[model samples]
Target: MCGKRWILDNKTLLREYIKKYRYFSLNNVVQSIGIKRCVAIKYLQLFKSEKIVFSAGRGFYTSEGREFIYPKISRVIKIRQLIIKEFPNLDFIIWNTLYFQPYYHHQQTHNITVVEVEYDGIQSVVEIISRFYRNVITESKRKLCTSEFDITNDPIIVRPFIRRSPRDGNEPRLEKMLVDIYIINYKYKIMADVDFWELWRSLFSLYRIDFSKLIDYAVGRRNMRVLISQLIDNAGLKEVIFDSKYDLLSNMTRKKGGRCRDGKTRHKTVGIIEKRNTI
Candidate 1:
């Protein structure tokens, strides 16, 4: 996952994410926060109307292409290998909308952004990773992430650039995703910095992986979805990162159950997680 900070759906904040993470799909963004589907779609449309996000697919897509669709980090690394075929001295960063001017402008955005996160050990990682594991809950982010309908009636997005000086210390939020994503009446745009594609190809040239056997690559896991992906793609690997949310969830359930081997409910592990999932 690209370490993106969330600026709730205020007029200024929504537009910034659109510009900074151009490749972000409304689905990816909202789904990360666990919003309901119809509600997600409803808001995406509104964003389109307000010109906050541009739709690439029907009722879907602020960021276009399969690259943004899946969050497989390994495959992403492989693709990075392919991209580095030419440019060598390349480094990438993840810049979210708030870093820019609060409008999802194509200009002042970044390709891959990372926020230094706290590692509270395995349990926390598992819980955060499990969002990808959800089954059958109407995935609001999946549908809403894109801009499907016409946004011609939407207002033009605007902003004034304010560069943050080194002295302006801002504390980073720890992936401030609420258990439930707040629905926006306006569509939120997912965008990638336009320059990232070029940077990707350049980065691909530096990888040690041999491209001869490379057909494509898949992200090895989901939680590292965005960050790992850019690195992988830059490696010149034929990459296609994917998520196995349900797959992981199933394994987690089986492994934990086998250890306890319990038929009865215990508030400690499985029961608690299942209850959390239900909410």
Candidate 2:
């Protein structure tokens, strides 16, 4: 009877810990609750059975309890397959603006889909895709080209990132998509501050964001981290800021000792948090 009581107590503790963190790794649980790594794994498995936690990736677990979902842009898979069939050896990632629709409250319709490839392969890939589809354009630093497609049809844009890494699949991961959206906004300035705040709030509320992956992508862009932290504060997502894995990153972006230069410790900006429609 005493052994059963101890087991129940540990299970309660584990659930509370998961509730606090929202997302965690195996090491996090072990250190937080002073349990053996193997024991923690068993507890996580039990939690999975109860739908209290689910695996986010190889070693990541989250209490979100839902499958990761991205926007469904029409013909995205067909476009990806065409690129793979034509250039089997080249690496590329295909995504569209719609992937970000869930985060922003305002519904912004994008008529173009993006296919990111190697910088040197941009023109060649664009040429190949153009042969197969109409209204294809290549985006470059020197000039921006408008797509010929109207509101009825979707246009395709072929571009490249400043730095590219090996991706396992044709679709970009969630972290990559989030970072890329910020980069795109920097270049295009299409999204307003209100849009960004809504996006951050929705993302934290709906999914378990992997801070390590996000930070890896934002290595040179430290300001992005600071901006994200500010958005979290403005959105009143204190729980996310207090998450164990993200606490350090969130704190670093704040003014020292939580006070700004003007001696204000709280965020000044506020934005609407609502579910935006995705096309």
Highest lDDT scorer: 2
Colliding residue pairs in candidate 2: none
- Poorest 10 consecutive residues of model 1 by lDDT? 176-185
**C-alpha lDDT of residue 182 in model 1:** 10
C-alpha lDDT values of all predictions: 0.30, 0.64
Best by TM-score: 2
lDDT of 1 by residue, 1-279 (tens): 232322244334445545555333445545554655664666567776766655432223342222111133442244234324322332221112233222222443322222111222223322432333321111121243224322222211111111221111222111111000111111332333333343334323322221111111111111222333333454232321124333222222322333335665333433434443311
Q: Model 2, range 90-200, lDDT digits (tens) per residue?
A: 878888777776556887765457788888888888888888788787777566653343433556768775453323477776666666666656555556867866776
Worst 10 residues of 2 by lDDT: 270-279
